[model samples]
Target: MKFKVDRAPLLRALSHVNGVAEKRNTIPILANVLLEHDGETLRLTATDMEIAVVEEIPSTATRAGAVTIPAAVLFEIVRKLPDGAEIEFNQESAEEPLHLRAGRYATSLNVLPVDDFPAMVAGDLPHHFTIQAGELRTLIDRTRFAMSNEETRYYLNGIYLHVVLEGKKNYLRAVATDGHRLAKVDTEAPLGVKSMPGIIVPRKTVTEVRKLLDNDGADVEVALSETRIQFRIGSILLTSKLVDGTFPEYSRVIPQNNSRILRVSKQDLAAAVGRVAAISQERSRPIKLTVTKNHLTLSAISPDQGIAQEELDENSVSYDSDDVEIGFQARYLTDITDQIDAEAEFALADSSSPTLIRDTEQPAVLYVLMPIRV
Candidate 1:
C-alpha cells in the first residue's frame, strides 16, 4: 500500500486515534492502529476492546491496501516532522514493514496482520439524537468529578445519563456520585431523546468525548443501543460499551427538605477551606464549618500539626439560620465549590445530614455532599 498525505492533517488524525491504543496489551494487535487507504482518503482506527476511536484524513494513494502499525511509533514520527511536510507511506505487502518518509527523514515500522485487528461492532443503534457540542460538554464537565473510582461498585464508576419528565417538559440529566459526594446537572432534552434508555457512560469514554468537543458550536450526532454508544464528531467516530450494571436510584440520596441557607462568595470559601485543611494530615483532611447568622468559620486540627482557623463574616457570607456546625472532607468541598461561579449557596438540615450546594448563577446544576464527623 502506498499513500501521500500532509503532515498537519495526518498528525492530527494520529493524535486522536493513538490515544485509544493501550500501552500494555496482552494481545499484540491491540497495541497497533489499522491504516486503510482507498485512493482518496486514509482511515486510521485504534481500539482497546472497550473503546474505539476512528478518524479519516485526505490522502493520495497510488496503491490501495491496508496494514497495521504501532500507533505510538507512527504518532511520534509524524508529530516531530516539519510543519507542512508531505508524508509518504509505502508497504510492499501486509507481511513487510511499513515505510514512512517526510523530507529528509525516513523510517520503517514493523507491521502486523490487518486480519488480527478487531472491530467494535455497533449493532443496531435504535436511539438517535443530535446535541450541541457545548451542551454535551456542560453535562460532562459538571458531573464527571464526582464519578466513583471504586471497582467493587462498578455501577458508580460512570455518569448516569437518563431522561426525565418534569410536568410538561422533558430534560436530560447527568448524575455522578462516589458515595461521599454527588453531582447532578440537567439540560433541555433534544428531540427524539425521550425514547432512549438510561445508560451509564464509562469514565474513559466521557473523557475522550470531552476532548473532541473543542468547537462548542459544532453539532454532535449520537446513536446508542442498550449495550453500546457511538458519537460522531466531524470526521471522527468514537464507540464505547455501556456499563452493564444497573445504577442505583440516585434520587433517594439527594436531600429534599434542607432549609438552612448559607450563601457565600465561592472564592472566599474555597480559599478558607484550603488554608485550614493544610493542618490536617489525614487522608480525608476533615474541615469543620461553623455557620451562624451572618458569620461562618472554618477550622481544622491535626495532632502533630496543631490547629488552623479562618472566619468569614457579613462581608463575605450571608446566613440567617440557627447555628450549625458541619464537617466535610477538604477535597470534596473544593471540588464542589470549584464548579460554582461567583456565589455558592449551601442548604443544610443539620450537622449530621447531607448538605446541598448550588452555583447561584446556574440553577440546573446541584451538588450533594455528605458530612463527616469532626
Candidate 2:
C-alpha cells in the first residue's frame, strides 16, 4: 500500500481518531487506526469497541491496499512535520513495516494485518432523519451539564433524546439529570423521527457528536437502531453504542406547580453565587439564598475560610412569595444560570422543595435544582 497526502488535511483527519485510539485498551490493535487506500481516497478508521469514527481524505495512491498503524504515533509525527510538506506512506508487503517519509524525516512503524482488526458490524438501521447542526448543538449544550457522572445509576449518565408533541406540534427534547439537578430543552422536531424510540446517548458519544456540529448551516444525517446511533458529517461518520440501562421517567421529577415566583437578571444571580462560592470548598460549597419582600441575599460559610455575603437591590428583583431561605450548591446554581442569557424566572414552593429555573423568553428550556441542606 502506498499513498501521498498533504499534511494539513491528513493532520485534521488524524485528530478525529486521537480520542478513540489513544484511549486505554486491552487489545493492541484497538490502539491503531486502519488505513485503506482505494487509489484515489484514503479511508481512516478508529474504534474502541463502544464507538467508531471513520473519515475519508483525498490522496494519491500508487497501490491499492490496507494497513493498520499506531494512530497516536502517526498523528504526532505528521503534526510535527514541516508545513506544506507532502507525506508519503509505503508498505511494500504485508510482512514489512509501514514506511513514512516527510521531507528529511523518515521512519518505519510496525503494521498490523487489516483482517485482525475488529470488524464493526452496523446492523440494520431502520430509523433515519436529518437535523440542522446548530439546533442539535443547542440541545446538547443546554442539558449536558446536568448529566450524572455517578456509576451506580448508569442510566442517568447520558442525555435522553426523544420526540414529543406539544399542542399537536412536534418537538425534540433532550433531558439530563444527576439526582441533584435536571435540565430539559426542546427544539422543533425534524421530519421522519415520529416513530423513533427514545435513546440514551452516552456521555462520550455526545461529546464526539457535539464536535461535528460546528457548522451551523450543515445538516447532520442521523441513523438509529435499537442500541446504536450513527451521525454523518461531511466525509466523517461516527457510530456509537447507546447506554443499555433504561432511563428513569424524568417527567415525574419535574414540578407540576410552584406558586412562588421570583424574576431576576440571570447575570446578576450567577455573579453573586460565583463570588460567594469562592470561600467554600467543593464537597460542601453550599450557598444560602434568602428572599424577602423584594430583596435577595446570598451568603456562604466555610470553617477554614471566611464567610461571604452579597446583598442585591430589592427593587431589581420581582417576587410574589413570602420570605423564604434556601440552600444550593453554588456550582450547580452557576451552571444552570450560565445557560440562560437574559432574565431568569425562579419558581420556589418552599425552602425544601426543588426550585425551577427558566428563561422567560425561552420557555422551551427548563432547569430543576434540588435544594441542598446547609
Candidate number achieving the greatest lDDT relative to the actual structure:
1
Alpha-carbon lDDT, every model: 0.94, 0.90
Model 2 misplaced regions, further than 4 Å? 314-316
Reference-based TM-score of each model = 0.97, 0.96
Roughly what TM-score does model 2 have, to 2 decimal places?
0.96
Clashing pairs in 1: none
Candidate 2 lDDT (Cα, whole model)? 0.90
Worst 10 residues of 1 by lDDT: 14-23
Show the lowest summed lDDT stretch of 10 residues, model 2. 17-26
CA shift of 265, model 1, Å:
0.8
Candidate 1 C-alpha lDDT tens digits along 1-374: 99999999888888888888987989989989999999999999999999999999999999999999999988898888888999999998778899988888999899988988998898899999999999999999999999999999899999999999998999999999999999999999999799999999999899889889989999999999999999999999999999998999989989999999999999999999999999988999999999999999999989999999999999999999899999999999999998999999999999999999999999999999999999
All models, RMSD in angstroms: 1.3, 1.5
Assess the local accuracy of residue 109 in candidate 1 as a C-alpha lDDT between 0 and 100.
94
